[model samples]
Target: MNRGLRIAVVLAGGLAALMLAGCGKHETAQATAVPAPAMKPAPPTPIEVKKEEVGGPTWDPEWDKIVELALPPAMLSGQVPHDVKRFCPAFYGMAEDDKRAFWAYFFQALAGAEAGLEPTVQAKHAQPEMAVKDEVTGRPGRTSGLLQLTYEDQKRYGCDFDWERDKQLKVGDPDRTILQPKNNLECGVKILDKQIIEKHKALLSASGYWSTLRPGTVSYRVFAKQMTNVPAACAVHNARKTVDGTR
Candidate 1:
């Protein structure tokens, strides 16, 4: 009689424990479940701000301002392109004083005359027949850059001028690089220096390299007008290193 009673009691106690644990699990499920929010997440913004600013030239207020102020707008029609084909080697190799005073005016005039002061636009010859074709694309490529650096000039100067548009877009593309005035203007001044010093053309103002250098042409007038403020030593006759270069 005692054994039977004890077994029945143990079975009832086990059943009660199981019922209690099932109720606890139901309550825990109710407590943990959550409903979703009504509103959708907002879209990300398109604006992107870089931590560091891309580098550009700290244009010299001293000489740069003078060059900026001097050039007249009427002169820049791309009719007379600046002779920037050799600008990279010529301008970079000149004396500092010559660079500041005379050469800047000379080159800027050519650039203004050639490209109308925009680096991206190519300079075109006023005469339709005289335009030179691009070596790469076989399309007639116009002169480009602040110096009216031509397609020919790019090859002549050893600057980057890729024939493939995609390749040029990636490397040594003058259209992109010339936009940087630091590179364009710097190379322009040097290229002009080459005409007088290296080529022995003897005339910064009258070099046969650019028709603008010759007197009586509209290009020369722009050159003369811009030089009104330049020192007297910075003239066509004195542009060369020696008189022997005049030939």
Candidate 2:
């Protein structure tokens, strides 16, 4: 009887060990399992922020954020912003072969100061425009586009792009002809040319016109210090219109 009891005890111990082993295996499997990472679009490469001091309206953090989103390194290059057909229509229209390159660089730098190459920028807080009717929905819209052209500029340039004519508008719905890249650029270039090339009012007006370029102003100092490319930009500005003044 004692021998039988010993055998039964051994059997029970073996069963317990088997149960524990099974549990260990289950735990191991659970521990090792992992979920796969979810798929997402690769984010755009980041541009380093220029940290410099300048005086003007208090810096809006939003402008930096907006610029980072819109302006890529490629867009800021003189080649891209200086292009004759696509980006800078102003360059193409320049009759003077002598100043074309300088003009392109000047405009590129100005773009950095303005909308950061964002064609659709509205300058919502600064320059308000006449509320024009949208031809499709009859909804009222205001000034927007590349160069942030204002309602005054639209009328000034005599740009009338009826939405009905453009089936392939960039935003899918036409904002207006003034807000379109081509129209806004045409107006903006003509104004720029008239200001410098035609009127010869001096390029200083360009720097003075935009607070960002005004010297000794907080914005100017900030741009000078912060924007790594300021020297290149200044070189272009000075080369083109130094007698007019520069930051």
- Note each model's CA RMSD in angstroms: 30.7, 23.4
Candidate 1 weakest lDDT stretch, 10 residues = 42-51
- Best candidate according to lDDT: 1
Candidate 1 achieves a global lDDT of 0.44
Indicate the TM-score of model 1.
0.45
Model 2, range 86-177, lDDT digits (tens) per residue? Answer: 21233323323212333333443454455554555654343232255534434454445545555555344454445454435554243556
lDDT value, residue 179 of candidate 1: 46
Question: Can you give the TM-score per candidate against the true fold?
Answer: 0.45, 0.39
Separately for all candidates shown, the number of backbone clashes (residues 3 or more apart, or on different chains) is 10, 9
* Tens-digit lDDT string for candidate 1 (88-111): 123334344434433344544455
Q: In model 1, where do residues sit more than 4 Å from their true spots?
A: 1-99, 126-129, 160-175, 204-207, 231-247
Once fitted onto the true fold, the runs of candidate 2 whose alpha carbons sit more than 4 angstroms away are 1-98, 126-143, 159-176, 206-247
